[model samples]
Target: MTPLVELSGAGFAYEDGPPVLRGVDLALREGRALALLGRNGSGKTTLMRLLSGGLRPASGVLSLDGVPVSYDRAGLTRLRTSVQLVVQDPDDQLFAASVEQDVSFGPMNLGLPREEVRARVEAALAALDITHLRDRPTHLLSFGQRKRAAIAGAVAMRPRVLILDEPTAGLDPDGQERLLDTLGVLSGTTVVMATHDVDLAVRWADDAAVLTPAGLRLGPAADLLCDPELLTAAGLRQAWSPAVTAFLRAHGLLAPGAPGPRTPQALTELLGGRPHP
Candidate 1:
């Protein structure tokens, strides 16, 4: 299948500094979840902005579903409608007085019919499990609720690809789990998330990519999370869950592998039995 989004040899730089992104190439396929992992200032946010067409690449090409994206107003608007980006801070996206209005803003801005906008808002709220928050004041919501509202706004746009920058940041375990479960059920949409949570990436993402001062590298999440050396190189650390380590050691599967755990299911497949004790 053709990729939902593709970036080829993409590079970007602010007015004064060196290029934040250099020769970055990525292809996000439909229904796949890709985790973007790196340390601070590794250009992950720059790459996200480039992908969402918020910033044009200084060189190379960005395409959506095979069509090249240009910097022209129409081209950029089309790209924005197809690829929605959720920023790290929820407050950046939630501007409307009420949650429903905030979620409806995107579709309404697209000139969708009022009824369609309402349906989209309702669906998005339901998808994010924030239907009860529909009439609440956005400013009064907690951090996790604001995050969900932001996500709901993105989903309301009905984009084919969802680009999330640090979706799990600043959330408790329960909040994180809730967001992860919601993201997991969003099928047929290409999801690319830039996050610092190695464990969440290992558990949630199907594939993983790392950005370093050197450049961008792509591989299976399991391989990346398992490799201590690779993690160190990328300015990340292994998310060695106690259950995962015990399972791997009991099954003799911890000898060596790719850098990361990849997924919780990998342990079951490797062990071929219930985890010991």
Candidate 2:
């Protein structure tokens, strides 16, 4: 499948500073979730911002669907409509007095008819399970609620691609799971996120990209997430599932062909109350 977005030899430097991202390449597929892993100051944010059209690269090519991305007013309007970005900090994005208005803002600004905007707002609220808070004041919402509201605002735009920066940050375990479930159902939209949560990234993303000062590496989650050298390069540790799988395999309790499950429920079912030998 053609990628929703592709980066080739992409490099960026801020106002004559040293390059933050250098020759980094990525191909984000439609309907697949791509997780970006990196340490602080590793240019993950720069890459996300570049992809979302917030910052243009000083060198190399960034394209959407094989065509180069345009940065002019007409170009941006189309890009913003096709790709919605939810920043890591919800407070920076949410400015409306009420949840409903906040969620409706994007569609309304799109020059959509009022009724159509209403429908989009309603669907976005329902999708994020924030319908009950529709009339609530934005200031009174909890951090999690605010995050959901922020997400709803973007989802209301019905973008073809959604990029979230550290979306799981500040979310509780259950909240993370709920968000994962919601992301899973974004059927035809490509989802890209930069997150510090290695465990979730291991299982959730269809593909993984590890960003280090050296460069960026992209591959299947299965191959890249479990590689210790790659993990160390990106300042990440081995994921928990692989360790458990190794232990069980060594103990002769698990079949050699047994599949390692990544999620909590999958692990619970796989163990089946089996006693440790």
Candidate 3:
């Protein structure tokens, strides 16, 4: 299947600066939740920017559904219509006075009719579970609400691919859980998030892409997160899932090949009926 988005041998660097990324390849399969994992300066944001038409590749090709993306205005419009990027900071994206206006900004800019823009704004607000905040002042929203507003702005664009940078950052545990729940409800949209949260990646992502000094490695989330050496090389700690799995195996609670739980609740359940060691 053709990737919804693909980068072929892509390499990028700031003007007059050393190469930040070199010879990178990535394919985003439709309908899959992918986690982009890397330490700071590993080119995760650069890769996301390349994918979302925010940056044109300096040395390679970026394609959408098998077609090379053009950097021209019309071409960028075509690309952004299918791909939307929500940056890490909500304040960076939220500028309008009200939530409704902010969310409507993208569709409004697309020359959509008023009714269409209103409809899109409402739908995006509902999708982010912030419909109640529609009329609220954007500046007054809580950090979590602002985050959702930022994402709602992108969702209003109705992109087939949603790229989020550090989606869970600055949220408390409950806020993070709610945001993850909202992400889960985005039924047909393919979600790509760049995050430093290894446990979230292991628990939620279907696929994982890790950037290492060597290059980018892409595979099933379970396969990638379970590899201690790979995580170490990528400058990430092993996620709790694999650590728990290993502990269970050593304790005779799980077979050598038995799959481990992904969440804290599941881990608690797995240890149920057994005395604490």
Candidate 4:
């Protein structure tokens, strides 16, 4: 199948700074989640901006579906509707009074019918499991609640590809799990999220892509998360789970032997001989 989004040899730079991204190439296939991992100021956000058409690249090409993206009015609208970007900070995205209004803003801006917009707002809230906050003031919500609301707003757009920047930042343990579960349920959508939470990326993303001063590196989520040297070089740390380690040790696949399971199914296979809880 053709990729939902593609970036080829894309490069960008700010007014006075050196290039934020250099020769970056990415492809988001349907029904796959790609995690963009990097430290602060590593050009992750800049790449998102370029993909979303918020900022045009100084060179190279970015295409959604098959059409090249430009700064033209039609291209902007196409990019906006096809790829919805949830900003890192909820405060920047939530400007409406109520939670419902904030979530409805995107579809409303697209000139969708009032009923359609209402249905989308309701569905987005339900997907994020925040229907209870529909009437609450956005400013009064907790940090986690605000993050969910921000995501709901992006979901309201019904975009084919969703780009979330640092979705797990500033959340408590419960909140993080809840948000991960929310992301887990989004089927048939191409998701590219930039997160420093290595554990979250390991558990939630189908593949992990690291952003470094050198360039973008794509590989298995578990392998990338387990490598301390690679993580440190990219300004990241592993999110090692105890259960994963135990399973690997049981199968004699933890380092010294063969590589351990990088996915849940593999873990299950390795532990199939053990009695179930």
**Whole-model Cα lDDT of every candidate shown, in order:** 0.86, 0.87, 0.93, 0.85
Q: Order the candidates by lDDT, highest first — what do you get?
A: 3, 2, 1, 4
Q: Residue-pair clashes per candidate, as listed?
A: 12, 0, 0, 0
Q: What is the lDDT of residue 264 in candidate 4?
A: 57
Error of 1 at 247 (Å): 8.3
Error of 2 at 106 (Å): 1.0
Residue 242 deviation, candidate 4, in Å?
9.8
**Cα lDDT of model 3 by residue, 1-277, tens digit:** 9999999999999999988999999999888999999999999999999999988899989999999998999999999999999999999999999999889989989999999998998899998999999999999999999999999999999999999999999999999999999999888899999998999998889999999999999999988988999999999999998898889899899987778987777887787844345
Q: Is candidate 1 or candidate 4 better by TM-score?
A: 1
Candidate 3 achieves a global lDDT of: 0.93
Q: How should the candidates be ordered by TM-score, best one leading?
A: 3, 2, 1, 4
Better of 1 and 3 by lDDT: 3
**TM-scores for all predictions:** 0.88, 0.94, 0.96, 0.87
Give per-residue CA lDDT, model 2, range 1-277, as digits (tens).
Answer: 7777888899999996888998988888878888999999999889988888899988888788888888999877777888889999999999999999999988988899999999999889988999999999999999999989999999999999899999889989899889989888777888998988788887798899999767998998877888888888889878888777777889886799887766556667777854343
List clashing residue pairs in candidate 2.
none
Candidate 4 residue pairs that clash: none
For candidate 1, the TM-score is 0.88
Show model 1 residue runs off by greater than 4 Å: 241-247, 250-277
> Tens digit of lDDT per residue, candidate 4, span 1-277?
6678888999998999888888888888888888999999999899999888888989889888877887789889988898989998999999999999999988999998899999999899999999999999999999999999999999989888999998888888888888888888888888988988787787788888898777888877766667777787898876666346755677666765555565555666766754345
lDDT of model number 4? 0.85
Candidate 4 wrong stretches, greater than 4 Å: 239-277
